[model samples]
Target: MSERKKSLITTINNQRKYSQVAKAAVLSSAMLARKNSSSRGAPGSAAPFGARESIAAISDMLSTQHKKPVRSSYVESDRVEWALKIACTISMITVCLHTPRTIELFPPLTYIILAADFISVSVFMLDSVLRIHYEGIFRCDSSYLSNRWSQFSVFISIIHLLSFLLHCYQLIGKLHFSEISLILLFSDKFFPFLHLNYRVWYGVIRSIRPFIIIRLIPLIVKFKLPKNRIEQLLKRSSQQVKNVTLFFVFFMTLYAIFGIQLFGRMDYHCVQPKTDPNNVTIMDLAIPDTMCAPEGIGGYECPNPMVCMQLNLNAKGEGFYGMFNDFGASVFTVYLAASEEGWVYVLYDCMDSLPSYLAFLYFCTLIFFLAWLVKNVFIAVITETFAEIRVQFSEMWQKKEVTLDEGFRKKLEKTDDGWRLIRLDGEVEAEGPKQKLQWVSSL
Candidate 1:
């Protein structure tokens, strides 16, 4: 080619590249202007502290960091993003299987499980960092952290990360690295106070994995169902279910406190060696030593001891768990009694030597308060919330009228009254139906 032709071709290529870049810049600016104009009248639109400002700040930070636009979408259309989600899911499952309980179930695979867990955790950490960077971690009210479910998911991941660090610390201690570090540092002790069971922490971390499913709402929402039928179905009961759950938790806590004060401190020991004089009662009346001995009539097995020790023997009587022998058992027992699910048996178990009337009255009062009163209150709250939500859903469904364009092949127009379905011959369906009725009447 001639030198003039080569120069012309280069100019054309340069012009095309510049044109593309110009188009991108124009498109971005137009989108920003459109968004700003649309949001002008909205709440906090004029305020610099609004969501748009925060979003712009985040976007600027991300662009500064990567020199590129960050991709974000409510739908899972991107293959790379979908692949990452799947990888995270698989990694979470792998870590869950390697929990302490599951590890104990399969002892021989301990090392293999631990190795998989570590690899999965590393992947999770990388995934989290990527997500934070993409979501603009510099902004306090960024979309990622502003969302409740996102916050929950990130919090759990952070806890799991800490648990992983604890695992590493445990490994270091097991390998006597702590001792060597002490010698190297020329100190008497290296992290002497850093003592914790990493296995238990890992188990706790694994238990929190189930909550990650809440953050998978976008995936479920993205499903191509007919008219968002799945979302409608979920909406029907979601609010009521949430209300019931909160009420149940509140009542359970109240009942747990009641049970702890009432029956939790009772110690059932057949042989009462000593007793507090001021605290002496008829329940403290101990059976003869012969009766409690191995060769005795009861054979040292008293299902319901008549004598009660002043000191609690329930799991060393230390923390709440120790004091009750089981943290949730007291609440559960009260619940079972309130529900009338074998309340007689529970009361019988506690009423061997104590006054039967007092115990019966105490239980009957609890049944009245929890079963009759609280249950009705819970029902009323749920019913009211459901009714309100039903009204809102009806209003929303009715208001959700949509118009569709079926291409230029089908002519369409709107009238002052409502939409007028137009045909090629300038006929309207509403007029056609009326004209047909008039013709029939004339005949």
Candidate 2:
């Protein structure tokens, strides 16, 4: 019985040793397979590199290879950027002040103003180029030529260059105190079409410089939260505002067309009385020109011994007096009435000219629809958009606060004395009150 027990034990021990060796062999084979899979794509391997990683590596290499190096101190300095900003402000002010009439009136200071414009434009062009080079090329990983900001910089640079050239051309004329021979030669030879209107083109180009004030938007946003909020509000409400504008314009145009058809050639004024001085008798005044109404037909009469004159018929000479003579004038009249600005006099004039009292109904309907209904709709749209933005901002602020509180809780720990605030690096920062600890623990 003892011998049989010994044999059984020996057999069991031998089987256990064999199972252990098999397990060791399986683990070693698994480790070798993992090592081989890891080192599959070496320098002398038949397999190629991973497609995704290869493309990423190539893209990184190319981006680093193509990026331009910044060499100019002026392009890198913050002071230079501020200086350019000041120049832009001065340029805007100069553009506002230096009109054609200003140049003609202040002939003695023309050269001085021209010099300032030249300097400002040069600075603008240089700054635009440097911005493209530094911010678009040196700082960006993408190609500068394809960058949108670089494209905008290029366009602005072209405008500044054109403005500078126009300024130089004007300076040449100013230097001669008239159109110089060189200018005439160029104008006649190269730009005969623009010769007469050279000043007009120059004025147009110089006027564009004032739009550089758009650059100050960033500075305004940095300093004022109200401006940023206004920007956000405008962005969010742009589509609604566009719809409202379209509605207003469509109704305004419809009313204008109706006014033109209803009140066309009807606004008559009595002027230039041709009375006989010797005869003291008041004879009936015959309508000389186009009459507003037939003789004693609509109770409309010429009060004075004057000729009937259509004041609104003339295209020029009479300014706003010609309100509803043509399509353009009719549009202006309807727009004015819709805005409720000086519409009472217009209504009375229409009443005197027309054969009936339909003008009252027309103007009342226009004012009610546009001024009351459409204007209120626009206001409501803007108010709703503003409210939505305010709520979104409040929610974002609450989320930020909650995140901060959670992070603080994560960095807190209980100690023997109280609750200690531990940093991310496992260092104790501060100890807090037991109540505060309990509050944080509750969270």
Report the number of the highest-lDDT candidate.
2
Query: In model 2, which runs have C-alpha deviations exceeding 4 angstroms?
Result: 1-77, 135-157, 175-197, 223-236, 272-299, 309-313, 320-322, 387-401, 404-443
Candidate 1 local lDDT, residue 19: 58
Worst-scoring 10-residue span by lDDT in model 2: 49-58
| Residue 317 in model 2: lDDT | 36
- lDDT string, candidate 2, 368-412, tens digits: 888899989999998998797765455334433443332333333
- Residue 237 error, candidate 1, Å: 12
**lDDT tens digits, residues 1-443, model 1?**
69999999999989967755543443344344446656877775564423333333233323333233556653224754565466457556765666557766886555665565566566556666666666766586655677765667668677666656655554554554477444534432454454332334444655665655555556446532222333454676677667776766776677667666655544444544465534544455554311222223222344453333334333423223312234477776777877877777667644543445645776777788778877887788678766755544543343222101111123334679764334445543555887889989999
TM-score of 1: 0.50
lDDT of 1: 0.53
